[model samples]
Target: MTNHKLLIVGTVAALAILVAGGAYLSGRSEADRFAQCRTGNVAGGMEAFGTDFTLTRQDGARVTAAEVFTRPSLLYFGYTFCPDVCPMDTARNAEAQALLAGQGSEVQLVFVTVDPRRDTPEVLTTFGEQFSEDIVGLTGSDEEIAAVNKGWRNYYKANDAEDDQYYLVDHMTNTFLVMAGGATAEFFPRDTPAEDMARKVGCFLDAAS
Candidate 1:
């Protein structure tokens, strides 16, 4: 298999193990609080995945996770220069966001760039608008971006290209549903359909409410 396929398979396997281990250790009965909303298990429940960090918005203003995740948000990490995977994955997220809006559930869409050196705020802004007006594109200094990536446990590696402006980033493609206060409700893989994503997100929203 190619490196990209191998990376995806490895990530899925790792997450599956984490989820299973967390479920086993929690020892909670099936009568959990968000039990009805959960279509699948999370590693350690709602708070397993997210962390506190700051990033620069497309407008070049710095914002904290608290400010960004004021609502149920779909958060993704990718670069604007990514040739194909990032575009398609983020478009899928936008479609899911639209579906939720039509059903009267508002969700924020956040895209953070992993390639901070290349993805300036202006570049990110243009890229995000191609997907959705409400999409909040974010980039930060290299240190800041690395911190957030570490917090989210996402992978990203930039290739050493002869042309600095043209390069590809290999990164994970998991879209996280993070609620207010940075608690992750669920995570959707790259291949999840928009319809399924909308349904699952609605379940979390309803259960939260």
Candidate 2:
């Protein structure tokens, strides 16, 4: 072939390469947009709340953190005997779950007891049933509970009980919304309204889906 013919062929090949490269990049950009794999970015890094945990479920079943967080979930840290704050907060969470269920949303609620000594699996099972059958009440050894709490950056302390009849637990009053696969999480105050909680959880579900 003549030199001119070879030059024309080379130009066509280069153009094809550029077009293919552009298409690949465009496709990758779209994938990244929808992935949303890590949204919990902060001053340090994209790390979010507790990634995984293991504890005894209300029914005395040993469940891993991975199992519980398979879908979008709401986690509330409190004990069964919490007289005022815990009861009220858990009740509110149950109401919010009801609201979401009405809209056909499938978000799970998890109640983790910071006071593990008195809140055994049996006690947690009974306490969780009072709110909703869907709630998973969790209790673990003191070390296990503490490790989980540290992962969540939550704090709690046991107050004195009179005659060991009733006790108070001072704990963080924040509930956490963990996205599917436990990749990200957001915090909401305990007093967050049911409507708002439902709306926010719906948004997270929509995004995850």
Model 2 lDDT, residue 193, Cα? 89
Give per-model CA RMSD: 15.6, 4.6
Clashes of 2: 0
Per-residue lDDT of candidate 2, residues 5-74 (tens digit): 9999999999999999999998877445433533344453324468578899988899998888877778
Q: Who wins the TM-score comparison?
A: 1
- Worst 10 contiguous positions by lDDT, candidate 2: 37-46
Give me the candidate number with maximum lDDT.
Answer: 1
TM-score of each: 0.82, 0.78
lDDT of 1 at 59: 97
In candidate 1, list every pair of residues with a backbone clash: none
- Segments in model 1 whose C-alpha atoms lie over 4 Å from true places: 1-31, 42-46, 161-163
